[model samples]
Target chain A: MSNTRMIELIGVQKSFGTLQVLKDISLTVDKGAVVALIGPSGSGKSTLLRSINLLTVPNSGYIRVGDHAMDFSSTQTLPRDRDLAAFRARTGMVFQGFNLFPHMTVEQNVMEGPVTVLGTPKAEARELALALLAKVGLADKAGMRPDSLSGGQKQRVAIARALAMKPDVMLFDEATSALDPELVGEVLAVIRSLAAEGMTMLLVTHEMAFARDVADRVVFMRDGCVVEEGDARQVIEQPSHPATQAFLSHFHNGLA
Target chain B: MQYQWDFGFLLQYKALIGVGVLYTIGFTIATAVSGLVVGCLVALLRLSHLRAATWVVTAFIEVFRCTPVLVQLVWCYYALPMLTGLELTPATAAFLTLTLYGASFYGEIIRGGIISVDLGQWDAGRALGMRRSQLMRRVVLPQALRRMVPPLVNQTVLQLKNTSLLSVLAVPDLLYQGQLITSASYRPLETYTMIAVIYFAILFPLTRLAHRLEARPGH
Candidate 1:
């Protein structure tokens, strides 16, 4: 990889009423690199992931993806809903809860964005949806509803739905956290395959082993800020920040 | 005792009673359709994030739902004329009253249905780049409507029976038609019994239809 930045955030801030969530955070994600964001619950890991897609626009920030710049502080707004929608289409999000449409089949859920948002032909979208479902190892269950599927299967379908959008960047917000321990492996395996395919992925995960094994760089976050970041092995073996040391020790002692 | 269970009276007034039956059907259909439209809009308003809009819808629903349908009919038929200073036909007043009554109850039903849909559906739609309108159309409404169907059918049937209250407004619906025949022929028991049977004839098929719909796969 040439280390060209696919996503950049500078001076990002977000607050919900009186409480500040993300405070002047900045990060850069290189093209074809898997950046894992690991932190305790409520540490703004998910908030940062959402900010990248403008799902939760930062209170003040300059966010650039590829060539497009979305500055929340700018007085002038994006022209129309269409402009914001187009930007969103380029950045797909996989939610922590597998938010599959229960009324729709796995194939239909995957096909929805391609057909409705992208305006692809129904037949073409269906073919692509089936292919995506197969990629996620749910080809046999394409016709089943989300209510029938296990949590892992539902998350895989959610991933397929996002992949069907053909996004330039995929953001996973603790995507495997909702799954059972045994089921998490299959979902992580699919994600690992995507990483091998050179997909630019931003994953916020609590699965330390998967992060250690799959992430090119693991960023340890605490108190709504990045405490440390480096190669997965080095970060796991050697930590410079006191916060990182405390966090790792807690987990290692089976107290987390 | 000789006047008891007079099939001859029923047979004699069949034409008049038939017209009454038609009025009941027409009123039921009109009110139910209008109520569904008003109810859905009101439900959307009530569920809106804005406090003012939700309050307005909440007050409207509360006022209508808490009051009696007969009183509402009287108010629409009599009170509205004095307030608005506009003359309305009995049919118009009765229709408006029935619509509003059904709207309030159906609004509650719709709100419940929308709330019952999993929050995950909304998240899925948002993550898929679906705007609010698309999310409502493609995900929320479909699922919500599925959940609303059984209660909606029950409401429709209730509105059908409630059309009897329109007789007081002189809309010449089934009950009024029954009253017309009964007074002229001096057959109260016979006329009202026939009226009851006619109401059953209309509601029975509707109940069956609702049952079949509820038994379907998605619902």
Candidate 2:
């Protein structure tokens, strides 16, 4: 029974000046569902993921994440400090570039969110950070700086940092896109493990095989609109919409 | 005519030069600390989104950068005491003037350092739910501080040497001590030469340190 909604966005609309990035969109992910959002370049997949965390605010929307609901519309009282913080704490994000704080050790990068935002005591935060590093297979490298790590390892540390906040939902925006081809497997392994553990996650990715295997739901978007969505096998294997077929054909044709 | 190189006078006047060294070192330390602190505050304000504050900081930086430090020091000595009704000593006036002047240069250097950091770093921190202030302290400031170090040391070295201008007020600094010895002992060459050597001695090491800092790029 899909009893709980981990994330829900209704009638979300976002535009940058005259360029609309998300056009009247509604999406929902149930608790423990792994949703993979796939699209061609300029299809607004990244922008849509960012809006769920309010990293990019939708011009008009009703966003419900776990327990907090925010309305972004004219005449509404905008989110206050505590409201924004509460909203953000519910969502954790991993980026395309693996933006770890270079001056900090891997452990410190992971500990930052808990200590500063959640006010977790230092000793406890350190312990949690170490454990998360181990989970990402970087516990041995926890004392090292981000600049010293490989791109894949740095991305893993970023994953640990976001997870340290114990967020209700995790967002990945092309998290593996910046890694070397050989380095991609390690990061993908970590995400595959997260999916196995039933973490409610929304990932924007280009790896067709990995998305087909790991995601329970596959959402295909093009030109700022949801073109097709269904069970992962159906959408990835038997796409019906002309736009979705063209997009997947392009991906399989080495255009990714 | 044979010119005499006299080493004897320095031995007799070592105590005067000692006092001068103490004063110069004191001014450098005081100015470096106070100027750096105030400069950081000003840089923060200038980089802030407050439009009026940015304009005010722009005027402040330009005025200080455009004018001569010597003129500013003289003004602090002569005009400030009369206007504020506070009895001013020359040493205090010079310190205050030098610090304010140094702050402007330091502010510009720090602003450059801040601007040099990657915008992607800011976005990354915010994506992880960090507030703007948290992102700055945790992510941005650390990288910027590394870039600021060489320029900061250069400013300090300049301030240390600039303190010699205090000699114009007959302040007990190295140049003033040299002048007093020149008048009393009738040995301008020995006194001024000693002062020049001392200035070079202090500044050369700092110059080399700046080069070393420049050599070590970001890790």
Candidate 3:
């Protein structure tokens, strides 16, 4: 991974009514880097990740992804829909739920972003979709509807759909969390291959082992604040903060 | 003295019955098509971010839905011309009333179907950088349309049934021609019974089609 900063967040904060979800969060990710965000349920990892694409607009903060940037605190009005869409096109996201368009076939699901957003020609988008499906190991299932696929297969198609846009970065919000235990491995394997190919990614995950194995950095958050962050192996294996250690203990006990 | 049933008198009125049936079918098709178009527009307005448009559309839908179709027909034919200062033929008034009435229900059904689509689908579309219109056309509507079919078909059947009220406006629909036949032959029993039978023929197939659509797997 290069040292050039790809994503930077400065004092990003978000609140919903009386509750503050993200508290002045600041972090940086380099090009080709994979960062795993590990935390408790209400730690705001997903919200933080979502804010990158302006999916959940932050109450106040500045987020810059490559050339596109948003300073939420500077403007009285929110960013224009056009600007938001342009910024979002830079990154791809995979939800816990596969969220495939049920009415579309697997190939159509993958081709949708390219054909609709990028305005790619249908024949070209079809080729790209086929290649993506093959990459995700679902080439034969192109014509099948999402309902007919297993959870693992659906998640892979979701991955392919996101990849069709040729995004600069990817966000995985507990992508494998909804899958059965056996199915989780296959989804993770696809993610692992992406990491090896040097795709920049930020993942909010409960998978501690995978975090240490695949992520270049691991950020531990709790109560809407970053508790500790460092090298993936160091943060996961030997956490310095009491909250981080306490959080890791639960996973250790569960695994045992 | 037992009364004798004269079944053969209706044969002479077949031309009148044919014209009535044609008018009934024509009104149903015209109103249904126009109503669906208006309904889609209403649903889109309701779903839009504009508060005033939403309020106006909501009021329009409620006004049409709360009042009876017969009252709407009478009002459109007799009352609307006075209010708007435009003369309307009986057929025109009947068409206008039925279209607006059907649109109210169609709009609600369409809105419900759209909102019923999972929120995650919206998220997925937004994440891919699709505009709201693009998302609706590419992702949301295709899925929503499947769930909307049975209800829409059901509403269309109701639309056809509503056309029966058109006879009060002298629009020459089946029931209106039946009245003519009754007055001419002095045989209300056979004429009205035949009218009901014709209505049954038209509506039965539509209802059955709706049921079949509803029963289809994976809906």
Query: What DockQ does every candidate get?
Result: 0.53, 0.43, 0.76
Residue pairs with backbone overlap in model 1: none
Q: lDDT tens digits, residues A1-256, model 2? A: 1349899988899899999999988999999999999999899999999899887878898888888788886535556645666688778899998878877889999998998877899999999999999999999998898888999999999999999989898999999999899999999999999988889999999988888889999999998999889998789888999888877886675423
TM-score of chain B of each: 0.95, 0.94, 0.95
Per-residue lDDT of B50 in model 1: 79
Clash pairs for candidate 3? none
TM-score of 1: 0.93
lDDT of 3 by residue, A101-128 (tens): 8888999999999999999999999999
Question: Model 3 chain B, poorest ten-residue lDDT window?
Answer: B210-219
DockQ of predicted candidate 3? 0.76
Query: What ranges in model 1 sit over 4 Å off?
Result: A1-3, A75-83, A253-256, B1-3, B215-219
Chain A, candidate 3, TM-score of 0.97
Residue A248 displacement in candidate 2 (angstroms): 2.1
lDDT of 2: 0.88
Model 1 misses residue B98 by how many Å? 1.4
Q: What does candidate 3 score on TM?
A: 0.95
Which candidate do you rate higher for TM-score, 2 or 3?
A: 3
Q: Which whole-number lDDT from 0 to 100 does residue B96 have in model 1? A: 90
**Residue A129 of model 2, lDDT score:** 95
lDDT of 2 by residue, B1-219 (tens): 999798686888899999998888888999889899889988999998789999998898888889988889888899887899987799888888888889999999999999998887876777667777777888899899888999999989989988989887668988888889899998999888898898899889989988888875652
